[model samples]
Target: MKKIFIISVLSLMLAVSVFSASKKKYGKEITVKETTKISEIIANPEKFEGKRVLVKGPIVDVCKERGCWIKIGSDKEFESIRFKVEDGVIVFPLDIKGMTAAAEGIVSVKKYSVEELIKSGEEHAKKEGTTFDASTVKEPKIVLQIKGEGARVDGK
Candidate 1:
């Protein structure tokens, strides 16, 4: 009876560990200890430029082609930040869109000319299977993004 009970306990523990290992880790391991809010980052991105930051949010969008990037939504409605990793370096799953993601990376600030913006917008639209209206882009735009180093995405 004692042997049987011990075996059962070990089996239960193993099963639990296996079942709970749902989070998918990608790229390098997360090293940042403090998490910056996505809204704060979006509101004052220049302050965090070239700095390493950790952030958490719902996976609002993912790169449709190679999963090279994910748009993590801020707590505030209509706000989100994109975490972009090198192509084929860390391909996030498209099915994880509704899940939560904790990502770490350096904040990048860049200015794109109107022509560059239009080109990128068109490319993005093609990737998203949507239409791009270049007329909406009237001037150069400065965008903030995270050049992702690593991420941990929770499964739904």
Candidate 2:
């Protein structure tokens, strides 16, 4: 009886250890730098790819169909860094445009061909009943993820 009880206790301990190990392996938490620059991210996308990144910038535009994404850059002339909401995540309000925001999420790389971008622009223009110039259209690599709350709309 004594031997059987000892064996049962040992088996239970082994099972608990295995369960804990499995949980740790599948769970991953990410931390992002607070002041990451678009130039740096573009220069080395691989370094930040799939990792949570925090960035602060003005919201240039918002898409009702595609969802909320911000363009990050010093000026509109420079190609803006685009960050889109990730899958299975709720997007922020569209009124965020023109508001300075700080967001955090997993960095993703998206590639679009010129032809594809033109088609997309045309579709968007049609939906909005506005003319879109495909000639000036740019196919940019984008980041997809969640936007965390950081600041109010007033830039305070």
Candidate 3:
């Protein structure tokens, strides 16, 4: 009887583990075999720009409205990279923040002047239903982001 009870407990644990490890896929299937470090991409974005890369990280932020983008944590502390998908193509769940995700996409780099940054910031803030403080703008900024094509987010 004790052996049977032990086996039952182990079976139940295995079942739960399998169930919780479910994955939710979005967009096309990821074809990239190599994974790139987020830190490396951010540090030298020019080299990676327009190249397809696969990156894995924790989901740090997501678009609250259209779910068109997600910011994933970088290998470096306090750094993250945004993966943006076409609106209505791949919609990430707002609640997916904090979950682990693997995404594949091409890197994109853009330079913005202070004025342009302020305008874009204000527009983004308005879309997010938040207020923007344009006075914070002090310098030109270069943005590196991913044009996401596919992703797989852990269910749990």
lDDT of each: 0.92, 0.60, 0.93
Which pairs of residues have clashing backbones in candidate 2?
A: none
lDDT of 1 at 92: 90
Candidate 1, TM-score vs. the true structure? 0.81
**Mind sharing the TM-score for model 3?**
0.80
* 1-156 per-residue lDDT for model 3 (tens digits): 999999999999999987666437889899999999999999999999999999999999999889999999998998999999999999998989999889999999999999999999999898878999999999999999999999999844
Rank order by TM-score, top first?
1, 3, 2
- Which residues of candidate 3, in runs, are more than 4 Å off? 1-23, 127-131
Cα deviation of 111, candidate 1, in Å: 0.5
Q: Provide TM-scores for the models.
A: 0.81, 0.56, 0.80
The prediction achieving the highest lDDT against the true structure is 3
Whichever of 1 and 2 has more lDDT, that candidate is 1
Residue range 21-64, candidate 2, lDDT tens digits: 54311112324456676666766777878766666667777666
User: On a 0 to 1 TM-score scale, where does candidate 2 land against the true structure?
Assistant: 0.56
